[model samples]
Target chain A: MPKPNNQDANSLLVLGGTSAVALAYARLRASEGKPIILVGRNSDKLKLNQADLAARTKKPVDIHVCDLSDTAILDKNWNAVTSMGHNISEVFLAYGLLGDQLKTQKDSQKFLASLNTNFVSAAMWAEKAFDHFAYKGSGQITVIGSVAGDRGRQSNYHYGTAKGALEIFCDGMAHRAARFKGAKINILLVKPGFIDTPMTDHLDKGGLLWASPEKIAKITLKAVFRGKRKIYAPWFWRFILLLIRMTPRFAFHKTGL
Target chain B: MKPVLSWGRINDKYCNVVRADYFADPNLLTIAESSDNGMLLAHGMGRSYGDSGLNKGGVIFQTTRQNHILDFDTQTGIIKARAGITLEEILRVSVPQGWFLPVTPGTKYVTLGGAVANDVHGKNHHKVGSLGAHIMRLSLTRSDRKTVICSPRTQKKLFNMTIGGLGLTGFINWVEFKLKPIESSYLETENIPYTSLDEFFSLSEESAKWPYTVAWIDCFAPKSKQGRGIFTRAKFSNYGALDIHRDDHIATWPFVTPALFLNRFSITAFNFLYRWRPGARMKGRSHYDSFFYPLDGINHWNRLYGKAGFFQHQSLIPLERSKEGIGDLLDIIKESKQGSFLAVLKLHGPEYSPGTMSFCRPGKGVSLALDFANKGQKTRQLLERLDACVLKHNGRTYPAKDGRMSAQTFQTAFPQWTKLEAMRDPKFSSSFWRRVSQTTS
Candidate 1:
């Protein structure tokens, strides 16, 4: 058990328990001796992660399996986890589907599923976490956005739009947290570049642009602790995305980036 | 996909690389089943000095992302982890808990899968044997879509074959190994400078009681000081705290050092200075990292040899012929003037590893490892001559460190190649295996 700051020991709640980035962040905070709660769709993956984190941290690791896309049951899912008497101090929303752009563009079912998981479902969960944290007036919520969210691209406009909306929601949540007088609530939005994760494994993941999940996780944790509102992971993506967004409409269409 | 080079960077082959996901790999079975042409090999860290981890014009399953601790028993010191987890990661968790790996190579960057595939050894080999001896069970996923759980008591043949199996048997999913209990992460060490082969042997005999023993000989030393070097030995200290070394200030070689930087003159000067250094004969407490993997402090230290890379030649000679065999080998290297940057010598006990293709012999012997810069034909010829010398002494070169061993030499050294080849997953193959087995895709 963690050395308690008050009556209860603070805990970290990861929305996407099996995500490489989320797990990396969890490991970084593991030395604090805080309990961790992992939520994901796959129970086997969750159990494996639970074992891994529990061993490394030597602390309690709880797991809950729920399809994040099922927005209808998010209330029940959130209640099932938060009601377990873990004084949740931080929540990391790090799950999404990078659906096939070409396939999803032609298929509405895939498009909605991607949109629902990335935005609607994710937004609903974020709201619940934000409300819970805001009610306590002392908590953190980190959402993993993407550089693609800065400017829409034809290749991944659906994902870009969903992440863009999520970022906007995070912006509002940060503002809301500030509105709570004397509250220490913090909201961090981390927009990462091309991370060399399994999600982007299909693409040619070479060159200086691609970053590892561990690197992003480190950057995200630093930003969370420092209470930064928004930042691009790897730092270089800020300029690259700036250039892409600055490109003229006609020229941008010609480049098809 | 990009080209995955070996640690030596000798074989410049562009491979179709596929990385496993963090906790789940839904396509792993599909990829293995489809790549039935024997061009697929599992790769982790790419730490092997040779092409055992490389497959040209083939798919390489990169398992680094699968790194995760599956379970750990603090009471029994038994730990089960994904094959992709590195030894450094294991130590970070285990060391503070008063446990350590049964056997670790010179570097902790190697993955559990790579360590098992190579059946790596440490200075403690004489006491605890190779890493294969400590492994309790392992889960191997083959190309046939079967996950076989093998241990010493069950699936024994496959279990033995998988150790030192060069990742050819199948993909190692997870490994359950016993950890040696330690009161502290520090070791009581001693460095004794010896002058000749005879004195070195005497020192080895004297230090038989030590758990870890190894020597660093200057290959460029004059004929009189031929086998002279510092013989270092160590055992776990009972007085220090169990704390893992935090490597926050490791120095990395920024780039490939110029080939001209490491010439005969520089190496000879370094060898002279290193031998006569102030602490050459010092005795004190040392951290396990400094005592076991001093080279690991310099990240990408291999780049010091230059862009063309270097070749690591490790050979084990029988005890009876060790003095003469080692003398002849040193003479050959000295005459060639192809001095090595790191030359290590150690005595091995008469302990056999469970791995069928393990490089160490069942009989007592002495193993010598040296690294020579890739001077093209000069280096190749020198290594071949060294191979001939080892073969004359009825010794075998380690496949894990070998980049170019003729099929004849390999077959002569390890006659059981046919057995391992027969059991090799038809869909799995490596450049080293192909070259040594004289097989084609």
Candidate 2:
């Protein structure tokens, strides 16, 4: 397969279009003349965001409805779309749900469902995207990881564990894809601290470095364009998390994270 | 290769925040040419009262790790070193050898790069301009990763950009500046008390003729005595006639105070006693370290602010708006019932660098610094109000000290913000800029 020229590679496929961070990323890319294809479960929200993005960019955007929680449905729709000439040069896998740990612990079904949505679904999408890019021989995949994955805390270890798996998985995928000749698949894993997003709207503000969605998206896009392997959103979180990880175990357990 | 580093966690009582980050030891490779693909922001002793040294997630070319003295020309008083070198380090080696940084901030722990970033003004700003004026040349790594040598005559844009660019234009790896030769570590210091704002200005104007002058204003003073404060002036002692000894035992404060200790009442009392203290006249041999970073005596002084860190709101108003601007600002603080004990006033001269967003300009700028207890939303609202006033007077807020000012105010304060944005590297960013500027629609 021949590499797509910049003009021919102007389409974006955002896996989690309903995400404000993902939407912001889409908006930024759209501003740079790339049309976006928003993929998510919420048809109404996706349509609303599509309209908002079109109004912002003054360009038409496409929308697709697919609930990633149902792996079968997601794969079916993904296969059908790829078959229909959707040559997406960029695949943003930003879908994830922060399931209530207490509820998940009480119900095994809930825990399994959360795990499938957060980790399993991400891996499936990554594998599919990698295969697609290998066939086309060029593309970028960006995954929104969490700083909680750096070190698990009592507060949200379940979510952290899921994110941790995704991070390691992406790291391995990046390493493996680099060996394939003529195939260019750059992976960006974003480890963000507390972000003022709908997913974290109920939680109390965390720290001085907690970033806004728009800020995270701007940094994320910048990193994607630069082909960064990994980035800590709101840069201070890098130092902050580094300190948290390096804290001596004897003192770490005593000092509340 | 993995980076070797040392780390320290200090909770500031003044700002009431905990700062835990890696500090590059004096022996580490502080600035590797390989890392120059991204820009580096030199962090001195982390005492700009704000974000000048913070590079967010990007690499902050830690200068403290490479504070070795490269060379010192004793005869002409020319000094060159890696930009990470601190005023305290220079004073440590030179005070005994009879030399000093041509300019020093209130704190000696400040890195040479920070002084240039803030273009720090001291008691003698009126006479010396700023630290940038004394800087002869700098070796910087631009965004393109080229190690370019810049001086006033060569690469003048990069030179000015590095000076006050807030570490945005590039990383300053090494700098060469003119140093003032000193005879002794002691200063001939005197404190003159002023009962009113007019008197403070008169004394500041009069004392400028001398080599050094700084005023400590009492914010709690009544309307009639609004600027009533203590004025301290100093000049290098004629050590040629006195016996001088170099001792490694630098005088420093040793303990951190409780956060609640720096409240309005405590600071007000401290200011009153400081202004009217009996030991107003003193002539003793003091190390350059003690003379500059008096606060350095107490480690983790910022911890005094408790768990909710504080914000230092420092602004520069045109000399014409000094009296009205400062007076109105103080009145607002008083009305808000917010207590500020630490307020220092100084007269600024002309700005030499053309850093697109340089905070200093031509005028007698008065900086009003206050520690607002990080009371969450309340504190943020207050800062927004203060930012409004700063904008009203055509003044700008320091990005280093600001964690909450909006992009609109930033645009207003820095009319050249769009131009700088155009120049920003897509790959480079910081938490400070990310939070305040990147979020704006």
Query: What TM-score does candidate 1 get on C-alpha atoms?
Result: 0.94
Tens digit per residue, CA lDDT, model 2, B197-251: 7787788778767777777777778887887777777887766422233322344
For model 1, the superposed segments whose C-alpha errors exceed 4 Å read A1-7, A248-250, B24-36, B247-249, B439-441
Candidate No. with top TM-score:
1
lDDT of 1: 0.88
Summarize candidate 1's per-residue lDDT along B235-303 as a digit string, tens digits: 999878998877453898889989888788888988888988987798998999888888889888888
Give iRMSD, candidate 2: 25.3
**Candidate 1 residue lDDT tens string, A1-257:** 33323226788999998888998888877755678999999999899888888997777788889998898898999898787668898999999988888998999999999999999999999899888887787898899998889998888899999999999999888888888886788889999998888788778767899888889998998898788989999999999999999998999999767
DockQ of 1: 0.69
Please list the residue runs of candidate 2 whose C-alpha ends up more than 4 Å from where it truly belongs after superposition.
A1-257, B1-44, B55-58, B240-262, B280-287, B353-356, B439-441
On lDDT, the leading prediction is 1
Locate the minimum summed-lDDT window of 10 residues in model 1 chain B.
B29-38
